[model samples]
Target: MSKANTAQFFESVKAHGFVRRSAVYRWMWTNYDDLSELLKEARPSWIVIARELNGIGLRDARGRDLASDNIRRVWLRVSRDLEKERQAARAQQRPAEPATSAREEPKRFNPSRLPANYRPDVEIKPQPSVPATSGPYQVPASIDVSEVPEFYTRKDGTVVHRTQEQRERIAQQRAGFEKETRHIDRYILTQKAK
Candidate 1:
């Protein structure tokens, strides 16, 4: 509690590499009763071991053990005070009032802000098909190539006889088809905008 003892305690904290100042409060709680003047003069050694090194546990940080105890004490004190106030208020009671103001009218929504073209009736286009090559069946015009069946494989286990160069050419064609469709989609969007 004295200045010299406080300084000595701080020195001990420093020696222990407890650089954080708030941890000194924890140190005080642990060493609650060793109020010796002799502890002041020594260049007090660092805390070698602590039950907690530093950092609040789930149980007791923020002086919560102390704070919770204080809170309970204050809460009891407040409840007692409130009970006294309530009794006093009851003793000095006045009569209740009758209803005074007129009731509020129900609100109506503004109609003009709603869209005139809002329609529950909607047209849904059919989803496009996936392009399949190397099949006897003709591929549909709207087929999505990414979902296309592998061109090299058939149900029969016979691999298609396209060369590596031909395979690369087909891949390039597929890529070009996808690229052209993206441009076509943009054109469709621009026409729709107009």
Candidate 2:
């Protein structure tokens, strides 16, 4: 690439927000036509191209100089991109054809082919609410005793059992929480009534 081309490549790279590796790909794509002509004339090796790229201060994504393998990989990608562009251009140049009866019809979804267990029409019923517990502990009916663990771990890295005193303290806290929630619920109900 020439000095002006290098300047233009950097400018394009900044404008497109391309990464270091992608910037090289973009540069290759932009100069593909000229590069193709040069390739046809000189047929230079990948090692020569790598050397030229390094000479021009063009580096890979890692900011290291390009190797023969790196150049070969980038060249392959550029060639593929150019071929795709050519194919697209050719496609655009060709006239569109009308749909014919000879063309196969698109497949339709068959609901009957679904598994026997599939029940799309079935209505999802809401679960029945558990009755509120009236015991001194005043534990929420939603909580299952079987699910609660017997032992608990503290932040200080100590394993402790749910002692009678700990249980009483927990029950007291739950009672206070229930009282506050009840007050809030009553206030909300009064506001809704208004």
Candidate 3:
């Protein structure tokens, strides 16, 4: 059925309650006059006028009941587009056969028909290496003496010594020593001088 007639559309939906067919008819007629006037000054499209009325209804203090009306138009547009796409897909699927000979050709591969030593001629370039941003991996470079110990012990009574974190430990101990010395100096200076 053609939904182009707003009056008939409203009449068909008015029986759902909250809105009467007479009220819908009155609204359409009132908006029609406004739409005509709008078409003159700014030459606005009918769609624009209709959308404006919907926006006003949604924003007006006494128009809370019309909130769903704005959504109706948006939903209608979406549903119509979706329906068209679905119908097109269904129509395409209903076709039983292609109209061209290329659609009937079958691809076949016989691996045994080729020579036993047949090899495709291809120039293979080495893949470029990308440096990893994050992951567990080992570098091929020699380990620095400062990073690893010079020796390590194995379970077979093998003793190995490796580079130690002695510098870090020494620096930490020195900082603590300085802090304690400062506190002692402060206590001594703060005592009453006889």
TM-score of each: 0.17, 0.42, 0.20
Q: Model 1, residue 103: displacement in angstroms? A: 99
Give the distance in Å from residue 107's predicted Cα in candidate 1 to where it truly belongs.
Answer: 94
Mark the regions of model 1 whose C-alpha exceeds 4 Å error after superposition: 1-162
Q: Kindly list the per-residue Cα lDDT of model 2 for residues 1-194, writing each as its tens digit.
A: 99999999999988866453465687888899898898899999989988988898888887988889878888888899789989999999998866765587877968889898887887899999767666534445465544667545567854445674498799999999999999999999999999
Report how far residue 95 has shifted in candidate 2, in Å: 1.4
Model 3 weakest 10-residue run by lDDT: 133-142
Candidate 1 collision pairs: 129-143
What ranges in model 3 sit over 4 Å off? Answer: 1-95, 98-101, 113-194
Better of 2 and 3 by TM-score: 2
Q: Across residues 67-102, which tens digit of lDDT does each residue of candidate 3 receive?
A: 345534544454465569689999888965567667
Models sorted by TM-score, best on top:
2, 3, 1
Candidate 1, residues 110-188: lDDT per residue as tens digits? 6676699765567888997556755554344464433544434446754443354377689999999999999999999
Model 2's TM-score against the true structure = 0.42
Deviation in Å, model 3, residue 81 alpha carbon: 4.1
Say which candidate scores most in TM-score.
Answer: 2
RMSD of 2: 21.7
Error of 3 at 41 (Å): 16
The positional error of residue 190 in candidate 3, measured at the CA in angstroms, is 95
